[model samples]
Target: MPSAISRFAKFAAIAALTSATVFASLDDAEARRAGSSGFGSRGTRTFQAPPVTSTAPAPAAPIERSMTPRPQTTAPATAQQPFGAQRPGLFGGFGRSMIGGLIAGGLLGMLLGHGFGGGFGFLGMLLQIALIGGAVMLAMRYFANRRQPSYGAGGQGGSFSRSNSMSPANNSSFQIPAIGSGAGSRASSRGNRPSDEIGLAQADLDQFEELLTDVQTAYGAEDYATLRRLTTPEAMSYLAEELGENATNGVRNRVSDVKLLQGDIAEAWREDGQEYATLAMRYSSIDAMVERDSGRVVSGDDRRPSESIEVWTFVRKSGADWKLAAIQGSEQRAA
Candidate 1:
């Protein structure tokens, strides 16, 4: 029985050792892919949104500006008619006179014993009074016209002159300032103020390419100081965590021969006093992992280089140096 127990203890020890080695290998592989270009969290997206601003784009592109001009127009002024220019009709001035004459005629007819009704009733009396009033009005109008001076053709000429005096001028001029000119002035002012605009110069673009290489070199060499300087606080934390995991598993990732194959701007914009740029970069590198003590190859190929495409986002304040803010993979791959 004692011999049997000794054999079981030996078997258990071998099993435990094998499990530890397997776990260590798995941890190293995970650490290798942890902070790779196609791995990790993409930082906060401040510009891309459902809530749009003046400078935001309908579709993603480089170098978007908000200084477009608006159209200009002028509405014509309308002419108003003079109050006294409206002429009166023939009965206009004799309304009260006609009313008085009708009443007087009715009363006279009643006193003559031919009351409101005779051969005709109240309607016949009203009709007779109306005819008498109309004749009297016509005689008065004729006398009044006879008293006034006659000017014939010359009177018609005077009427035209009065009409000309009453109507307003037809050719009035109005000035509407051009909106395009104002927009040009605003654009010039913005050009003079560097802070208002966020444009990437050729030199700025070169720096981005240089950083792509420098960051990879520093990370491979386990240079935390260089990583901190080249990346944002959030990105630094992620890189640090990955490196810590690799160290704990007694392994290290070695990246070399890093080269940018192709690159282009995906989108760039300025917001909240900061400039942000997202770039799609295709690169090739020799990426591999090795054990800490014996330096045995644990994962990946050291001699064979691999190519990958990734989207990287960088951000900086006005007149400040750019730093890596986020990273995202083009294709999802299992670790």
Candidate 2:
């Protein structure tokens, strides 16, 4: 019933209205978001919207943090020591080494001292001094005099006889022809006879033994000063050197089996205004065990009871008692 041209116009107008409605809906959503942020004008078109924010939040400021110190950590199972303990220091190790070295040095010193002769190399000299010292002491005790001539055996001034069978002047077997003094006559006659004979008083023998005992005690005690006083200077020095060695090596000597077999004054003579007496003695002795710190021995038959001969010549100076001048020892001359 309607004209064709009117229908066409109506259809076009409907299409235009539909497009406008869709545009409006989209604009409403934008406006809602802007209003919440105060960016929208009053009375702007409003509509429901999906949840939204007007401006993206400023990207979170990059966090700035620092690492902090931590407590000691536990050691791994493979470690030998526990946690927090430290190793030994340089000085500690050095101290241990020094202690070990000192111990080794001391042991070596002792071995060298005892393993070799005379106690050891340096110690032998000391032992020699001790031996000489002990020997001299025994000599002093045993060989302090010589035998006096028997009354019936000689015409010496110190002899007296109580028998008529032997002539009172001189025994037939012990003749001393009177002679005028001459150098040749004295040399052939007096020199052949003993220079002189002297008797040993019991008191003299006792005193000699006492002095000798004192010397022996000193030697046993290693008192070198006493030994020097009782013996000659040369003898003292010899002994001192030996004692020094003994101190170094730690060895000592002892003499035993001393017997005063015979002792008497050999002669009372004057030479250069000095009086002297020659004494002869016989005895037996042996080297015995004394000390062995350095580990040595003087090997021989020390207790064999063999005799020895000793000759001790003495000199007396003004204001001084008799002192030993020289001494001689002989194993073959025993008796």
lDDT of 1 by residue, 195-228 (tens): 2124566666677777788877787788999999
TM-score of 1: 0.43
lDDT by residue for model 2 over 227-321, one digit each (tens)?
76665554455445545654565455454544444443333455555555443444444433334664345432334543433434454555555
lDDT top scorer: 1
Residue 162 lDDT in candidate 2: 7
Clashes of each: 0, 7
Listed in order, each prediction's TM-score against the native is 0.43, 0.35
Residues forming the 10-long window of minimal summed lDDT in candidate 1: 155-164
